[model samples]
Target: MRYGLAWCMSTFGGPIGQALGLTLAEGAYAPVAWMLLGACWIAALVSFLDGRRRRRLLASQTGLGSLRAVDWRQFEMLVSEAFRRQGYTVRETGLDGSDGGIDLILQRDGATTLVQCKQWRSQLVDVRLVREMYGLLVHHQADAVKIVAIGNYTADARRFVHGKPIELICGDALLAMVRESQAAGTVSKQTRRRA
Candidate 1:
């Protein structure tokens, strides 16, 4: 379950609570049912609004300058959305509190890829960070590891993944991906409208 969904469930008790409340609605319990139903509605609205906000953020990323303006969590969401557009099933790991774990897990054609997103506007990703990502790839037995950043990577970081199953996407390269994904989304929407 996603972190947001889990939190919603804990706070609102979700559809199950709504159903139970409805079934038990009587002279004394009617108010409780209405309250539970209202809570569920609020949770659903919040989830929908959040998803819309993330989509808007991804669509507005036109360049490295725009990318740099996003927060770390938004950066992760943007990367995840880009990969999803490329046909990967993306799962956000919700590790925003710490910088030590994988931020997204991508699966396509039975191969898994771990993604680490860095919203470092002024800091270049160094070889040490690339090495740590490589270690995580090996530890998780994943097919590949991708580190996406708003800035660039050090030359040593680029060299470390020369022949490895690690990809360092940063700066212009990352911007290109976001652009391609955005173009693809637009084309698909147009196609759907035509049909």
Candidate 2:
């Protein structure tokens, strides 16, 4: 918005100035237009690079974006990294192999969120899993519960959390997060540290 508005102003201000009988220098318009164009170009370049990095992050999550191809561990790591990119300090609790239902804890803006990364691709994730995550919210003292599933959830699963603080992240929603987190940072699958 910043650069775009500058671009519009510079591209039109000279003509408007002329119409209003403002005596601007002849060479003024070109330089201002060039400057505005440069700024817009830079913003465009930055946006493009950020978008490309985010796409890469989303694609490599499942090794070419196929959810079924990824193991549960990789999916969990991907969710953690995604949260990390979104300015959250993500702590991976699932690595201990006995996390008691919580996989990742995301802390940001003085709020804590518990995330359960469920890569249940073979079958629909049901209400039991959602209930387990909800139950941990009080035990862990978390502000919210998020179930990040690579696959879809059962209708019962969705209905269980209606009017609740539980957030269900499926494939499309996860991709949206990847896009929104572009400014956060790029994540390399190989160098993605556990947790």
Candidate 3:
């Protein structure tokens, strides 16, 4: 969605601008450089602002630790940002509504984890979803799998992940993790400044 576009624009902006600078002019190095620099700066700045805005929204909305108050898309982004704060590189695979299999893929310390976010409101997430994600682990080559549910899971679903590599973060646990991740990020920033 917008996140993917923003990331792509930010990531390619610098290099593409530089390339344009060389191709657009023959000897006008000064003008080209200025324009390219401006382009690159604007792209990077917009991306930074968007990411900061999303992160701030994530923290502020989760302050109450209530998941039902947020919209479905926001929940997914919130989950993504929470993991990002926890020092995991998170990538959103698909767009907003059509997230084929996994919503997020996380990597940290050379370990990869696939995450499927379910905004089931008050409904109990079924075992079928969990089993589908488990099947995708090998296909995605992930070290583990996690299911993030805004609501609770079915009894059968809970039993399914027992002794399995799949970790289910129910509503309560998900909120706690978000709070913990944000707190960890705060402490990390403070420690860096003190050092």
Candidate number of the best lDDT: 1
Instruction: Rank candidates by TM-score, best first.
Output: 3, 1, 2
Q: Residue 30 in candidate 2 has what lDDT?
A: 57
Give a tens-digit lDDT track for model 2, residues 1-195: 335444555567686734422322323455666887999999999979855654564546433266556677666766776787777998889967787898998999999999988777667889998888888997878899998876789999999999888999987887677555543443444357654
Give residue 85's error in model 1 in angstroms: 1.1
Task: Supply candidate 2's per-residue lDDT for 76.
Answer: 71
Runs off by more than 4 Å, candidate 3: 1-26, 29-31, 62-65, 192-195
TM-score for all predictions?
Answer: 0.76, 0.61, 0.78
Poorly placed runs, candidate 1 (over 4 Å): 1-44
Model 3 lDDT per residue over 1-195, tens place = 234434444457687755544444434456645877899999999989978877776667553345677777777888888899888999987446777788899999999999988878768889999899989997877899999987888899989989888999987788788888778778878999999
Q: Lowest-lDDT window of 10 residues in candidate 3?
A: 1-10
| Top TM-score hit | 3
How many clashing residue pairs, candidate 3?
Answer: 0
Ranking of predictions according to lDDT: 1, 3, 2
